[model samples]
Target: MSHYWDNLSARTNGQHTSEEFESAAYRLVVEQVIYYADRHSRATYWLIEGFERDFREALAPLGITLDVNRQLRYVYAKPQYAKAGTASVAQTLLALVLRALYDEGARLGQFTDDGEVVCDLVELEEKYRLMTGRELPGKGEFSELMRTMKRWGIAKKSDESLVQRGDSDQTLPYAVIIRPAIADILGEMALLRLAQWKELDHMPRIEDTESEDDHEVTE
Candidate 1:
């Protein structure tokens, strides 16, 4: 028990007891990425910064490792043993599209002062066409994927209704706040591989020979 833990316990009336806090920390790493800008990330970040040894020790037995990027100001989990081909073709394509849009938004100074990049469905679709020479996912699939991305802290939609409707015209540029977590999700090596794939005009297919090492935690 550290002084920090003591203060946290006092603030939360022991509701965030050590066991409870550790469980919450582990859940955060497993379920959602921890970003400095996300309000919910504060507690997990505090736990990692203040009780890193305890946190790591607790997760070590589960074969999950914490990847803390100080420069990026975020944390995510990686399995010690690689899982095979976790990303479906649609998911991989969507991630690449988002990464491309993130880069474009940054280059155009479309990011907010707080460093969130905002992109709309229309822009995403156009970019997808340009990059892949293929149509974007159907509306239902696209909306579902967006919801999944939102859950994983990659992006946040401005209007839930617009997402549900899945009509780009009706939504008329529904903006998604792209968080810094995208960089961590895609990473440098993944992006390089995607670039190579694109140069070779390799269309993403379900049967594409993607190794576990080439895939990231899209699900």
Candidate 2:
């Protein structure tokens, strides 16, 4: 994470503001980007929370909404089309859809009446199968991955919930946006593919830095 932050800082030339950093965090995470914050400083928390706030804000313009339970500290995102008073939906549309599916389980009494909706593992796998038209993974493997995703906020569970079925407790609310963060880099790879397929120079060309020999000759 730290390495990624360093790269991001260099790319931005140290011009990123708190809000920008937060928004960037969302974009990075949504794109499955990894970065490390200043572990030794208070900056880490600021960066994490700021990014979350900015992420939620980003969804607002896209007509998405989110709801955070102050008491339970649960966060929920959904489309803003019909739900006007709900919170902003700054996450990608793919994420929004997954969250809604998780929400359905919440409304269906998966948790205690007051508990929030985390995603149901079984349902999540089923949804994944449907989306990709592929076979789902075994329960154990999928559940473990889900928990890890939840911890990272790459995917999240409800903060509070009453266990409905002993085993089937929560529901999933977000899609894992980036499948292969390295293999499928967001900007460069996507742009390059577009340029090739579209047969146009859509991608911006980056100039290479001067070599040591060139620098020495110039000096």
Candidate 3:
């Protein structure tokens, strides 16, 4: 692995140093995902794509799988196993809901130039109720949850400063831009489990909700 890292560190001749690889790997693991469209991570995204094999080999021993979505221009790590309580029910349910909403938007051809779905919280709330028969968490809790979503590359608030102080400001952003990475996180199996949430009244364990190749419920 060090050999590969050393090779990568030298790939750019004098333009980059070993620390470049170290920094990129650190972000890849710690941030969990990177997208070419993200201004902050664009260079790291390219570096990972350029030396994907090296990154994969290095991450493998840690039981992490690198999923590079070339068409979508993003990459994320999947842990082979999840620790107990890695995700609260709120987090897991919300992620599954976002994945479903992304699919729904794709089916309707509603996408931005970046292939992301944009919708206000009203829609998200309705969908959450339709799938889980429960209201969303409180505003502060929802806000905190979105921070995790952003960190994982799943979704994000379109306007970070657009929060409204009252319910009348529904048109204000409370808007979420669902990234393509959401599909990679939850996949079709999450949709199937939505039916279970309705019919069986069961909140799936993280182990049960994972798509076949991924098992981590995320933090």
Candidate 2 accuracy as lDDT: 0.39
RMSD of candidate 2 to the true fold?
17.3
Q: Per-residue CA lDDT of candidate 3, range 154-203, in tens?
A: 89998653544575754464588999977876767667766655654455
Q: Encode model 2's per-residue lDDT on 1-219: one tens digit a residue.
A: 445445545665577644545454454334333323113323433444444554455556666554433332233344435421221111122233344444455457554333434444455567654543434556565456555443334454443433445565553443332211112112233222222322322233112324222111000
Question: If scored against the real structure, what TM-score would every candidate get?
Answer: 0.68, 0.27, 0.79
What shift in Å separates residue 146 of candidate 1 from its native position after superposition? 1.2
Candidate number with greatest TM-score: 3
The lDDT per prediction is 0.66, 0.39, 0.79
Superior by lDDT: candidate 2 or candidate 3 = 3
Cα distance off (Å), candidate 1, residue 108: 4.7
> In candidate 1, what are the lDDT values of residues 19-38, reduced to their tens digit?
65656565765665777766
Q: What is the C-alpha RMSD of each candidate to the true structure, in Å?
A: 6.0, 17.3, 6.0
Total backbone collisions for each predicted model: 0, 21, 0
Off by over 4 Å in 2: 1-68, 74-98, 106-110, 118-120, 137-144, 154-219
lDDT order of candidates, best first?
3, 1, 2
